[model samples]
Structure formats: C-alpha cells, structure tokens
Target: MRFDTRLVHAGHELAEGTGDVVPPLHLASTYAHGVQDPPAYFYARGENPTREALERALAALEDVRFATVFASGQAAGATALATLAGAGRVIVSDDVYGGTYALLTSSRLDVRPVDLADPAAVADAFADPWAAEALVWVETPTNPMLKVADLAEVCRRAHARGCLVLVDNTLAGPALQQPLRWGADVTLCSTTKSVAGHLDVLGGALVHDRADLHDLFTTHRTTTGSVPSPFDSFLVHRGLKTLSLRTARQVETAGKLASALRESPHVAEVRYPGLPGHPGHEVAARQMSGFGSVVAFRYRADVAGLLRRSRYFADAVSLGGVRSLAQCPATTTHRPIPPDVRLRLGITDDLVRLSVGIEDPEDLLEDLLQALSPS
Candidate 1:
C-alpha cells in the first residue's frame, strides 16, 4: 500500500468482537488472564493493545522491523543512547537541538560535540583515541540551524569503526526522510512534533532495522516504564492519518516564509535547506523528498523587539504543530550550552527559529513582515 493509505489503515484491524470501525481505547492497567498462562497484555507498563497497535503502525511506516514508543522525545533519545552505549563509551553528535544537547552533555555519558556541516570534523571526532566505542547521533536539517548531514557517508564511516549511527528524524519526519534506509541502525523521533501534528499530546518513538537493538530498546522501555498512555497513543494514531497532508502544507508555508525572510532588510542570514544558496541545499534535496517545515534566520537589529511585535507567530517552545511558533534559541532552547559553543554552532542571539504551520501562506508572510519591521 502507498504511504497515505498505510498511514490510515496499516495497523488497524477492525474489532473482530465488536466490529467497531475505530480502534477502542484499552484503559485498564491490568488485563484479565483467561487461562493458566496469561494474555498478551499483563500490565500497562509492559503492553497495551492501543499502544502496541500504534507502535506496529509506526514500524510499518518507517519500514523497520520494530518500533517502541516513549513518554517524550528525550526519553526515547536517552534510552536509545543508554541502551547502545556502555560505561566510558563516547558519543559524537551535532551541537543542535537544545533538548538533545542537554541530554548528552548533562548526563554522565561521555560525548564529543562536532560541527555536522563539516563531514571531515565528524570523521575526525570518531577517529579520536577517546572514541574507541563511540556511537554517532545525527540530526539532519538539524534543529534551529537546519544543517544537513550526509547520512549514508556518516553511517559507513561510523560502522567501519563498529560505532552505531542513530538519526533524530523529528525535523524531517518519516514522510520526508527515512534514516534506516540511508544506513542508520536506528531512527528516533519526538512524535509529539510532526507525527502527532496537533500539539495536544507528548510522545516519542524509536524505529530500528536491527532486531537486537530493537529488543534492547523495547526491554529498556518496559523496565524503565517510559511508555506513553493508551490515550496518547490513540491520539497520535489519529494524527498520523493526516500527516502527509499537514506536512505538505507546512512545507509550502515554510518555502514562502523563507523567501520572504531572505528578501527582508532586517534579516541577515536565512538558514533553510530548501533555499537554493543554503550550504546544505543540494545534500537535503538528495536525501529528503521535501524540505521540512522549520526555518531559522538571524536579524540585523534587536531580536527581542522584533519578536515582541509579532501577532501571528507565538513566542513559544516546541515545533511541528498546526499553529505557527517563533522562538529565540540563544535564550529559550540553546541556553544550556555555553555561549561560545552556541556561537560556534551558528546559534546566535539574533537568530529566530520559526515552525511554519498549516496556516495560509499570505497571512504568515504578512505577520512575519510586520514582526521583522522596526518597532
């Protein structure tokens, strides 16, 4: 079946007993055992019919053997890293996505941040003597900056050293790019963002082609009790039905916004892989079916003043929702990192990351123009 059809019908087997068209929510914490041995579900932490259905659907969508859902994106990321890396093992990652940086750096785990734009730097980071058992975690069209990484090459180099490669596909959802197909062992995402699309629920997921890794992550999830509620799982599945349509609208709006920002006087640099002059444009075009919905740009003047003047774009946190969001990363998201590190990664105080919504493109453009205009 095609992607859109799969999105709606993949894991949903209509109720055999009740003939319910929509999947029913299994709310019980524990399931009754009919016989001496027990049913598939014993406890909520271990399993639920609704959550399992969603997991199976996501695994099918990503073309992976297995998938596991988590309470949040960070939980999925941390679990994947923790399950893969042991004591003193190193992690090489891009200094993008504030939540990821916080998880890697603040945790007891050893990590080395690298400039993802430079493939040589990444290769060198892996070659360092301290990285003997390293795992490479990449976020392509990386958060805030939208920098692209050559996934196939990175995976090849990392695998040569026996290091696992995991890609955070939150920015470019499974609809746009599939990291496992490009050679990543694991692909993780904050389903709350693009997959859920409504911003009403919080969920995370990990999809893996390797059965061993999938089993390990699934074990970790059950033991750790980081699984999402059945209601959340049902909501995400409902949201998945329209993922393609919403993403198409988001991509269109983002392109319009990127062009508008580039031509504006207050804007100094527009960082979007879709833009022709963007450093990673060609690489993004090669890997992704469509450039994602997020765009980041820096201003020539007072960023706070500009954000304050906006009516349409909310100065908010989180991305990939149906409503537009604008945020200053230097203060809101990337503030945990040192100023110098953020500067090196091109996350400046004047920068604004915009999560373009499914709203009318002309309305978005008008709101942005007013926001960027001098207050």
Candidate 2:
C-alpha cells in the first residue's frame, strides 16, 4: 500500500464483535488475568490496546519493525540515551534539541558535541579508541537552527566503528523523512508536533529494526512508566491519517516565506532546507523527500520585536501545527541551552524560527513582510 493508505489502514484491524470503525481508547490500567492462563495484556504499563495500535501504525509508517510511544519527546530521547549509557560515551550534533542536551550533560556519560555536517569531524570523533563503544546522535534540520546532517554518511561512519546512530525526526516527520532507511539504527520524534499535529496532543516515539534495542527501551518504558495515555495515542493515530496533506501544504507555504525572507535587506540569512543557499539544502535533498515545514532565519533587526509584531503567526514555542507560529530560539525553545553553547551553535539573538502552517500563503508572507519592514 502507498503511504496514505498505510496511514489510514495499517493498524486498524477490527474484529466483527467490536464493529466500531474507530478503535476504542483502552483506558483500563489493568486487565483481567488468572495465574493459570497466559495473558496478552495484563497491565497498561506493559501494554495497552490503544497504544499498541498506534505503535503498529507508526512502525508501518516509519518502515520499522517496532516502536515505543512515550509520555513526551524528551522522555523517548532520554530513554534511548540512558539505555546506551553503559555502552560508551555519546556524541550529539551541536544544534541538538536543548532538552536532549540537558539530558546528556546531566548524566555521567561523557556527552560530546560536534558538527555532524562535517564528515571529517564525525569520522575523527568515532575514530578515537573510545569510539568503538560510542553512540552517535543526529538531528538533521536540527531544532531551531535548521542545519541538516548527512544522515547516510554519518550512519556509515558510525556503523563502521561499531557505533549506533539515532536520528531525531521531529522537525522532518515521517511524511518528509525516514532515517532508518538511511542506515540509522534508530529514529525518534516528538509525535506531539507533527504526528499529533493539531497541537492537541503530547506524545513521543522511537522506531527501529533492532530487536535487542527494542526490548531495552520497552523494558525501560514499562519499568519507569513513561508511556503515553491511550487517548493521546489515539489522537496521534488520527492525526497521522492526514499528515501528508498537512505537511505538503505547510512546506509549500514555508518555501514561499523563505524566499521572501531571503530577499529582505533586513535578513542576514534564511535557513530553509528548500532554499538553495541554505548550507543543508543539498544534503537535505539527498536524504529527505521534503524539506519540512519549519524555517529559521537570522535578521538584522530586533527578532523579539518582530515576533511580537507578527499578526498572523502566534509568537510561541513548538511547531508542526495547522496555525503558523514564530519564536526566538534564544528565549523560547532553546533557552535551556547555555548562552555560550547556543552562540557556538549559531543560535543567535537575532535568529527567528517559523513553523509554517496550512494557512493561506499570502497572509503568512504579508505578516512576515510587515514585521520586518522599516515601518
């Protein structure tokens, strides 16, 4: 089946007894079980029918054998890192999500930050003797910076050195990019954004082919109880049914806005992967099917003021919604990152990130124009 067909039909296997077309939210925390009989589901923490259906759907969508949904994107990320901590030091991209950064820095693992776009630097990082046991973390079209990593190249280099590669696919959802196909061992995302895209739900997920790693994360989730609610899982599943339609519309609007921003004298740089001048445009072209809906640009004027002045876009954090939003990474999404580190990663005070929505392109474009005008 095509992707759309899969989205709407993959995990929806309903028996005649429960003739409801939509799956019910299995909110029962515990299921009836007897010691003499084997139980497929004895506890919600271990498994819930609603979460299972969503996981199955996501796994099919991401082209992976397994998936584990979490309470939040950070919880999924932290679980992946924590599971691998005993293996060796973890290396992450410089523009990694601030929450992911906080998770690693607070841990005992020697979390190293480097430029994943620099193949030579990545090779060198994994070449160290310690690299034999290392784990490589990548976030292409990274957070607010919008930098793209050569996921295929990074995976090749890491796997050659016996390191595992995990790609954060939140910015470019499965509708646009699938990292596991590029040799990444695992792909994770905040389903809260693109998957449950209406901005109505909060959930995270990890999808991969490896059985061992699947058991590891599943055990951790079951033990720690960081699983998402059944209702949230149902919402994520529903949102995915229309993901491709929403993403395509958002990406089209983003390209138009990015071109306009690039032409502005007040703009220092526009970091849309669809834009030719963006450092990651070519790499994104190579690894992704679409350039995603988010665009980041550095402007010469007061970015905070620009965000506040925007009429169409809500000045807020978080992306992947039907309504457009603008935020200054320094004070919003990436604020948890140390100022110096943020600067080193090119997240400047003048930088603004936009999450394009399915709104009319002209309105979004005009809103940006007015905000950046010399009025």
In terms of TM-score, which candidate is strongest? 2
- What C-alpha lDDT values do all the predictions have? 0.86, 0.87
Candidate 1 C-alpha error for residue 216, in Å: 1.4
C-alpha TM-scores of all predictions = 0.96, 0.97
What are the runs in model 1 whose C-alpha is more than 4 Å off? 35-38
Q: Give per-residue CA lDDT, model 2, range 1-375, as digits (tens).
A: 889888888887875597767767888898887752676887888989899888889999877789989999999988998897568588889888778888888888887888888777887887887777688889988998888888888888888888888899999999999999899988989999988889999999999988998899999999999999999899999998899999999998999999998899999888889998887889999888889899988889887678778898999888999999998888877888999888888888888899998999998898889999756
Cα error, candidate 1, residue 235 (Å): 1.0
Per-residue C-alpha lDDT of model 1 across residues 217-318, encoded as one tens digit per residue: 888998989999999999998898899999999998999899989999889999889999998898899999999999999999888888788887889988
Model 2, TM vs. native: 0.97
Candidate 2: where is the Cα deviation over 4 Å? 34-38
